[model samples]
Every structure is written in C-alpha cells, then in structure tokens.
Target: MKTTSQSRMRMVPTITNETIIALIGLYCLAVVMGYGRFLFTATLPDIMTQLTLSTTVAGWLASVNYIGYFIGALIAMFVPQRTTWQTLMLWTAMSVITTMMLAIPSLPIMLWYLVRLLAGIASGIAMILSSTLVIQSFSLERRALLSTLHYAGIGVGISASAILTWWLLSLDYHFDVIWLIAGLSSLPLLWLLLGIRPDNAADANPQPRSIHQTYINFKRSLYEAISGNGKAISLLSTSYVLAGFGYITSTTFLPVMATNQLADTYAGLQIWLVVGVSIIIFNPVWGILAKRIGEINTLIGLTLLQALGMFSPLWFAGALGLYANAIIVGMTFAGMVSMTLNIIKNMNPVYSNLLIGLATLAYALGQFIGPLVTVALAGDNDNFDAGLLAAGIGLLMGLGLLLWFRQLPQKSV
Candidate 1:
C-alpha cells in the first residue's frame, strides 16, 4: 500500500518555479495596481463627498497620481537590470507606506497630492519590475500563459479593492478607515514577497551597468527600431496613447457615474466589482484567442470592443448601461495592454525593452491627461456625456491606426 501510494504521488505533477514566480507577480500587481493605485478610484465618490471637492480638483488629484506613475515608469526604463529585484522591493514598501498615509484625517490638499503621487510612483515602479521579473523567469513556450496569469493580478487586485470598499461602506466605515484597512491588509502579502527570491540564472551573476549607459543603449535601440519600423511603431504608440485616454475616463468615474445615475451607493460599487470580476474571468480567454487568431487582430478587435463599450453608457440607460460598460471595458482593457506590448516586442525582440518602455510612456501620458480632459469636457454641470463620447472617438481613431498598421508589410527586425 505504501509503494502504491508513492507511485501515485510521483505521477502527479508538482508546481514549477515559473508558476511560483507568476503567483508572486500576481500578488505584487494586486497590491500595487489594485489597492495602492486603484483604491482611489473605488473610493473617489466618497472622498469627493466627504471633502466637498470640486470635479476639477478631483480630476487634478487623479491626474497627479498618473503624473507620478509616468515619472516612475520613465525611471524604471533606465533602472539597471541587476537591481530590479531590490528596486521592486523598495517600491513595494513605498506603496504600502503611501497607502497607509492616505488614512490621515484632514490632510491638506497639497499633502493629499504628495501622498497620491508617491503611491502612484510606487505602483508604477512595482508594476514594471514585477512584470519584467515574471517575463524573464519564464521560457518563451510558457510565457504567454504565465503572463496572462500574472496580469490577472490587476483584476484580482481591482476586484479585491472593490469588494473591500463595498464591505467597508456597508459597515459605515469612512474612506480613511477603508484606506487604513487596505494598507494593513497588504502587510501579509509584503511579508510573503520577501520569501520570493529570483530563480532565474541570469540573476545569479548580473553585470552592473550605470543608469546613463542603460539609457544610452535604450535610446540607441529605440532609434534603430523606429528607423526600421517607423510607421508601424508610430501607429501603435499613438493607438496606445488613445487607449490610455479612452479607458481612463470611465475607469476613474464609473462608480461616481453609477451613484449619480442609480442614486444607490451599493449599486454603484457593484458595477466596479462586476468590472473586476469580468477582468479576472475573461483576461485569460484573450490569450487563448490570440493563439488562434493573431496578436494584431486580437488587439484591433479589443480596441473596437472597448470603443463600443465606452459609447454604451450614452446609448443605454440606468444600471443597465453602467453594468454593460463595466463588463465590456473590464474584459478588454488589460488584454489590450498585454497584446500591444507583445506586438511591439515581437517587432524588434532585441530592442523590446526600449520599445515597451516608449509605449508605456505614451500610455502614461494619455492617462495623465485623460481625467483633466474629461473633467474639462464635463464642465460645470459635471455631465460626463460629452467626455464619454470623446473617449469613444479616441478609441475609434486608435482602431483606425491599428487597421492601417495591419495593412503595412511585415518587416523582419
């Protein structure tokens, strides 16, 4: 009986190191992207109410966070490869600290700006580092699937944030307490992160390089890639910018929109929750679909779908429109990101780092501008109809660029 049991156990497959690394990446994203970054979105309506903040001020606050994110991403692009793990840990710690700071009561608006900005920076650096860690650890054959799993962390984090917000609201906890609990909740994950050492062989004896050298190399590679695939790369980057602008308006204000339209806080929160759930459930499906179709096709389709989702609220009414918007947008946004980066990387595998870095910067700029533009379009009445329409138009323009790029002849890098 013992021999038989041993044999059965041997037949079962054990989890691989790549799987462990992917899980670690997921946790990192969940905490940083989901809680540290997006918790603001989930709690924005309440914060606005409690602080009596104007729509313009609220938009500025959100834009400040993205500005920090943009700077952090730019910083990450030049960070020495050898220090990625340490940098990730440092940023993760910062993320935790900054999140907790949001709990301080009656903080000055400038302080609020400073805290959110720091949190955004932390989230941005952690995001880039964690993604790099996961991708480098896995082999090409398994990369796509593992990456999908890693990206699922965004959805997991978003969903968890939404749920926690909903629960706290139900318990009549103020936004401060919610932020406190959210910070405290991440402590365990931080502890777990310490145990996740890099198993990649390259990490064993990494060569040191100065940030200046790294930047020069990256700049040189980027120039070569653009020189070779100028039109394709330009179109893709511009599309990504529009995508960043297109999705963020809804991402930031969906809950607030829900509360306004439905007049029910719980229902408003539920819409965000549904988005998280949809992202978690459908993100992997896109990876599978990409295998059957192609990355470009998948990306174009996603962009089109997202554009339609952006326009849905204008056409549909009440909770129905909000839910539709949430589900559709959630389903495509993350996939769009993964696909775009993948496409660019495939264009010039040697220069992929710089290519992806450039794409990310463009996306970040769009996100930084998105809320400010949306709020400006929203005007004194705080009506988002015009903003939503503009967002959809941006997506459509992006889609058109993608189609044009698709028609271009493929060139080997």
Candidate 2:
C-alpha cells in the first residue's frame, strides 16, 4: 500500500524548472515592460499637468522613447546568443535606474528626453532577452503553454501600475512621488530575479572575435534564415509593423483620451485597469484558440477585431465606446506579440533570437512613427479622432497583409 501510494504521488506533476523560469519571466516583464515602459502612459496626464507640458512636447517625448527602443532592438539583434542572459540582467538594472530617475523634480526637457530614451532602450532589451529565454526554454521542454504566463507579466505590470497610480492620485500624491514609489516597488522583483539563474551558461566566457567578423556572421545567418521563406517572412514583418503602429496610439493615449472624454480622472484609470485585466484574462485564451484554429487564422481574426476596436470610439458615444475599445485592444495586443514571435521562432528554431530581434526592430520603427504621425494629425486642438482613424486604417492594412501571408504555401510559413 505504501509503495502504491508513493508511485501515485510521483505520478502527480510538480513544479518544474520551466515553470519556475516562466514565473520569473512574468515578474521580470512586469518590472521591465510593464512598470518601466507603460508607467509613463499611466501617469502621463499627471506628468503633463505638473510639468506644464504641451501635447506636442508630450508626443515628442513618446517618439524619442520609441527611437531609443528602435536602437535597442537593433543592438539586441547582434547580441551573441551565449551572452543573452547576462546582457538581459544588465539591461534590467538599467530599467530600474531610469524608472527611479523620473522621480527627480524640475528637470529640463532635454534631461527628460534622455531619461525616457534610456528607459526605452532598457525596456526593448529586457523584453526581447526575457522573451527569448523564457520561450526557448519552454519550447525545449515541450511546455509552450507556459509562454502565456510569461507574457501575462505585461498585463500584470500594467494593472499594478494603474492601480498604484489610481490610489496615489486619490491621496493627492504628486507625479514625482508616484514615480518614486513605482521605482522602489520593483526592487523586490529585481532581487528575486537575481537569485534565479537561467538554464543557459550565462557566465560562460565568449571567444574573442572581431566586430567585423561578428557582423558578417550575423548577416549571413539572417540571410540564410529568411532566404527560404522570404515572401512569407516579408509579409509577416510588414504586418507586424502595422500592428505596432496601429496599437501604440491607444496604448500610449487611452487613459488621457478617457479622462478628456469623461472629465473624471478616476474614470480614465479605471479604463486603463480594464485593459490590463482584459489582457490577463484573454492572453491565454488566444494561445488555446491558435491551437484550435491555426496561428495564421488566429492572427487574421484578431487583427480584424483590433481594427474594429480602434474604430469603436468614433462609432459609439461617450465612455461606452472607450470601454469597448479598451477591452478589445487590451485582450489582443499582448496576444498578437506572443503569437507573432512564436510563429517566427517556429519558422527557424535555430535562429529564434535573431528572428525575434528583427521583428522587434520592425515593430519599434512603427512605434517610433506612431506618436509623431498621430500628434501631427491631431494638430493644435489636440483632437485625436483623425489619428485614431489613421491607426484603424493601418491595422486594416496589416490585416490585408496577413491575408496575403495566409494564402502563401503552408510549408514556407
């Protein structure tokens, strides 16, 4: 009886290394991507009011950050696979420093720009490296479902920041204080991250190679990876660019938009919270749906859905439309990211890191363009309607590309 009981107990699944890694990834993302990146979006209205900044200035700041992210993704593409873990730790520390710097008061605009730019670079590197580590680990273990948990960190971080902001505002806390508190909150997570080592030999010494040789090798590998599936890859990359452009305006400005429309500060935060919660709930659903309907088809359906969400505020009245938009956009954006990366990784597992970096580079360029174009279209009155419309159109264009991609030979994808 004892032997049978022990055998049954052994059969029960327990916490595995991949699961622990996934959880660590979740927290790392919550800090780097969530608090480090989106905290600005959550606190933007307060920052603008406190700093006496114009909409155009705010748009410029956002664009500058995306430019930094673009540069970071470019750098990540060239990062040696053997060094990804160590490099990720370095960038994550940078994220913490930049987040804390935002707490400084009365800084010049140039300083603000520099800080945000640095933060963006940190975010981009942390995002790519963390995802690369978590997904590759899970894929090796044949536990792909864990990737959803890893991605869920973004939503968790967003939700946590929104909640913190909402509470602080109720207490009449200044934007600087909010920044400080957010920064300090990440310390525990960072400590936890430090204690957990990646499965990779992150401390391994690298073989000396000339920069020129490294670049040549990278170029050759990238070329070889894309050569067989050039058409499909191109379509996917173009669509991802559109996805980045289409979603960012909403990601960056939704809280502000809601506050403007509702004339209630808390209402906007609530809406942002809704977005976070929706992401947490639905991101996993997307993975399961992809299994049932095929990833390409799932991408098509979600792209169309998000485009509709982008247009909802224009069609519907008041906060109702904003809420609808929040839920739909929130649910789909993270899923789109994970799904797109997963597809590319599966395309060539040997070069997944390079593929992911390339995709991120494309996405960051679109992000860099989004705010500038939106602000330009919005003009002096700060009317975002036209910009929102443009974002929807971009998503539709991306949807068209996905459709084209789907029509390509299945073996190529």
Which candidate has the top score in lDDT? 2
Candidate 2 lDDT by residue in tens digits, 1-413: 75684455455343347778788889899988888888888998888898888889998889888888888888888787788877888889899888889888787889999999998899888888888876776754444578888999999988998999999999999778887998888887655555444434434558889989988998998997787888888999999999999999888888888888897758878988988999899988988888789888888888999999999999997898899999998899888888888888779877777888888888998898999988999888888888889999999999999998999888999
Q: How high is each candidate's TM-score?
A: 0.90, 0.93
The local distance difference test score of model 2 is 0.85
Candidate 1 per-residue C-alpha lDDT over 354-403 given as tens digits, one digit per residue, 9 for 90 to 100: 56767877788889989998999998988998889999999999999999
Per-candidate total of colliding backbone pairs: 0, 0
Question: All models: lDDT?
Answer: 0.84, 0.85
- What is the lDDT for 243 in model 1? 96
